[model samples]
Target: MNSYMKHGFAVAALSAACNAAFAADDITVIKIGSAAPTTGAIANLGKENENGARLAVEDVNRRGLVINGKKIKLELDAVDDQADPRQGTQVAQRLVDDGVVAVVGHLNSGVSIAASRIYHDAQILQISPDSTNPKFTQQGFNTTYRLVATDAQQSPVLAHYALETLKAKKVAIVDDSTAYGQGLADQFSSAVKSGGATVVAREATNDKTIDFKGVITKIKGQSPDVIFYGGMDATAGPFIKQVAQLGLNAKVLGGDGTCSDEVIALAGPAVDRLVCSIAGLPLSRMKAGPAFEKEYQQRFGMPVQIYAPYAYDAVMVIVDAMKKSGSTDHAKILAAASATDYQGLTGQIQFDDKGDVRSPRLTLYGYKDGKKTLLTTMTP
Candidate 1:
């Protein structure tokens, strides 16, 4: 053949080879579900959690991830649970039905507890970014996992802080009557009592109750050195505001739910007296936290509230499992996730047999100068 003919033949053969390789490396979509209270009192928290998951999905896609010899495209199926248990279960069913290989949400411990059974039955992996109540992992579901420490871990820290750090003799406790609220309150009450502190008053309220005057009136009579609230920022904010209004001198304490930027905004000047516990190191303390926060703010146009890093890490954890398993099969993903020990932006995430993060850390934070100030870090 002539030189031109030979060159043309070589180019045609190379084109054929490239086409075959491209056809063999087909792309597939893998769906991940995230459910949270996207519309109710604590929507800011839920939105922040979802944003973390979104950022993970975006990053994974941008990186051109491949699994089992096939190019993978991650898709997030984020749902609004309204922060309601009933709604959470419904969302769980929907996510399972939608064939998500894994899930990365249900920010409330109550929601996570209620929704976990569904994910378990579906054999899909469910990793919670927040959800600190101990009952979440105690139910013994293989599919259940959490990125943060449980209420069993946080309540004692808060209780000890109130008793030792704050030097409180008399304490009053209030719960929002939900699974999470009641659970944490019970743990705190027990912890304080065990520490030789007095729980002078115990009150109950619903998550939606805006008025705390009646409860405060009852609690004021006790004259507690600190009042611990077992609820989210929406309720805790108003409760703290009322604490200031009622001329109550006691400090306010709460778990991860009340630990957010929204709390300071809601409580206004009253936030000075507010102290809260979050499940891991503060954003400033995490090695990758500062950079993650900067990138997250640039991507989402908002600062990280709480659990965004956890949620982001949860997504990465699930994807890491998928990569290890080399398949998107639910069972394989669950097995891989159960054995995950990924080092995420949050921390080293290694799950114990109960699907809980081992050696989880907690941080005590208070608002100072309109920003969250880290008081201490503890492991309980």
Candidate 2:
């Protein structure tokens, strides 16, 4: 059979297995699907997301959650989608086939966009830590939940900072050609346009291409005052390196994807003007930031990445919803999540009309001298 047919069958079979089947048994095995890039290109990010989720699972089980007179033990079934959408869809189907109660994964919005439908049909709740596409929850999928702020919330904030704060007019845009990358690029472009700044050029590159000399050359030709990259740090780092070698005189404006230590390490000194907007982690500027950052460092023995806190919060949000619902039944979980109003390590986690987080704080960062410094923040 063709791949599409196979995908359809898997989704169908999965829906039949898990959709609202255990509506009566609220204390059934809480199977939680966790899909991320455990292998292949983006393994580093995948592992961090996994770590956050695992930590929460441990905490939940330790608390000995009592539901329906039975102790609830969360069973986290992890899978490696390798940051690929096809693999993510398959993993979602497998989890539904296994009758998982919920899920917390698909680190990229690209993967989540493809997998959410399968979970929706199966009535299996999914709480994503990193997927930021507004469409994921806006598709009328009650099962879809996310802890990260969407590009719709961060893009315009970044654009306003670029023109008002950074004082840049001519800006260029680039994306990785994936769902998350292109969608973020579009939002950022719209924001830039609204800010009265012109995007001199827009370009796209696939996940495979490592060399960005061609794109850099084109960017240099336009000589934009600033450049906005709506993709992750994986390729953005190397792209910055090449852009530096060619001496492109433009301030770098990137989204949350570039707000990682990995990007700083790869881009090095060339990232002096690196400006980015991210779903504000409470570990940096908040009164709780220093404590959480310190604890995370002590436990993990390393600086926390962008998504760790978000992932940790995603797990907490799901667990909180389960507690509030007083049951792990799929429908109960949905109702509980819809009424969530809790403060997370990321901030006060609340959903809006589209089921996306509302009033999320977007923080901007800049690389000045030899350190990444906070530039500003605002609501989007």
- What is the per-residue lDDT of model 2 for residues 1-380, given as tens digits with 9 covering 90 to 100? 99999999999988877765654365546877788988876677888788778767776787777775766888778888889999999988998898777788888888998998998888777888888877888898888888767888888777887788878788898889988888888998998898888889999998766799998898899989888887777787877877888998777778787777778778878877678777765366666667766766777787777777777777788888778888878768877888899887777889875677777777778787657787766666
Give one digit per residue, the lDDT tens place, for model 1 in 60-107.
999998887788899999999999889999999999999999999788
Estimate the TM-score of every prediction. 0.93, 0.88
lDDT of 2 at 310: 76
| Candidate 1: residue pairs that collide | 132-151
lDDT of each: 0.91, 0.80
**Which candidate has the highest TM-score of all?**
1
Colliding residue pairs in candidate 2 = none
